[model samples]
Target: MIDFKVLSDYAATFTHSENDLLRQMEEKAAEIYIPIMQPSAMAFLQQLIRWRSARKILELGTAIGYSSIRMALAAGNDTTIVSVERDEAMIEEATQNIEALNLQERIQIVAGDATDDLSEVASAAPYDLILIDAAKVQYEHLFEKCSGLLADQGIIVTDNVFFHGLVCDIDAVQKKQLHRLVKKVDAFNHFLSEREDFDTIFLTVGDGMAVSTKRSCAEGER
Candidate 1:
């Protein structure tokens, strides 16, 4: 396998730099030991939002609001994003960041468990895009809950499915403490791949990402 980190860094060199606010937010996340979206994954997400002309977005994680900000910026001024974060501290930080960027109207942060908060998210349903970057173990449950909330033509993008490349390496799993997590992620990957209602592709980008588009009912029936 190629060194994806090296290639991802090289690819980022050609892309434009994030604004000073986002740059500072990224620094803050790093200083706090909070993980944010990788550059390659962030770029992919931005492109997806722009290509889909996403108007309503739902994000499962707001980790310092880095990815949410990127998505909002990419989708333009009219788009609205409802992001969820379980941690109150992260919510506070993310809210501050979003407000500082003058995007309070465009992005709303919900503070609660994804399972519980998703019910609130459903009120804004038929979202053009749903981003899942929350707990690795709850991915399948999150997908199930959010799938019904998606627009017929909408797309779902999940991050960190690879879980640091542990999903694909059985030997590493047996030797490490990530057996349960690796198992769950692997199962989630398989579940997504086999879903009849959606067409899914797993990519080798940042920690691996899975992009799934809901198939038409007729197409799914076949």
Candidate 2:
């Protein structure tokens, strides 16, 4: 396996720098030890948004509004993002961040357990894109819920599928006590990849991202 730290640094050299505000936000997140998406993952998401022209997005985790803001900015001003965060502190911070960015109208932070709050998110159904970055152990459940909420051509992007590389190396000490979580993530990856109704691609970028696009009936038949 490649040293992702080095690869991420090398990729940063080719990507544009974050704006001062975003940079500051990232610095704050790091200071507080909040796990936010890596720069490479953010870049990939921006490009994906542009490519898909996604207008309605649902984010399972709103960690200080980093990915949510990035997606809204990339999808244009009219896009709407419903982000769920179970942590009250994160919800408050994310709401403030979105409001400070003047994106309050574009992003809504829902505070509650994802499993319980997802039903509310589904009310805005047929989301063009769904991003999952919350609890690694609950990924399969989230994916199952997303299937009914996603648009026909919608895409689901799941982060941390690699689980710090433990999913690929179950015996690795990195997953010592969390072996069960690693196993579940690995199984979820297999489930997503083998799903007949979705075309999935697992990328090595940013701790592994599983991008799955639901297959239409016609496309699945062929």
Residue-by-residue lDDT tens digits, candidate 2, 1-222: 777667866775565534666888877876978888877877898899999999999999998888998888899989989999988888888888888889999998887777774566878888999999999889999899888899997999999888777776787655455988888999999999789999999987777889999998789788
Clashing pairs in 2: none
Q: Candidate 1 on 1-222: residue-level lDDT in tens?
A: 767667766776665536998878766766877888877788888998888899899999898999988999999999889999989988998889898889999999887888884566878888999999998889999999889889986899999988887776856667455798888999999999989899999887777899999987778678
Residue pairs clashing, model 1: none
Q: All models: lDDT?
A: 0.86, 0.86
Q: What's the C-alpha lDDT at position 169 in model 2? A: 78
Model 1: residues with Cα > 4 Å off, grouped in runs:
117-119, 174-176
Window of ten residues with lowest summed lDDT in model 1? 168-177
Query: Could you tell me the lDDT of residue 25 within candidate 1?
Result: 72
For each candidate in turn, give its C-alpha RMSD to the true structure in angstroms.
1.7, 1.7
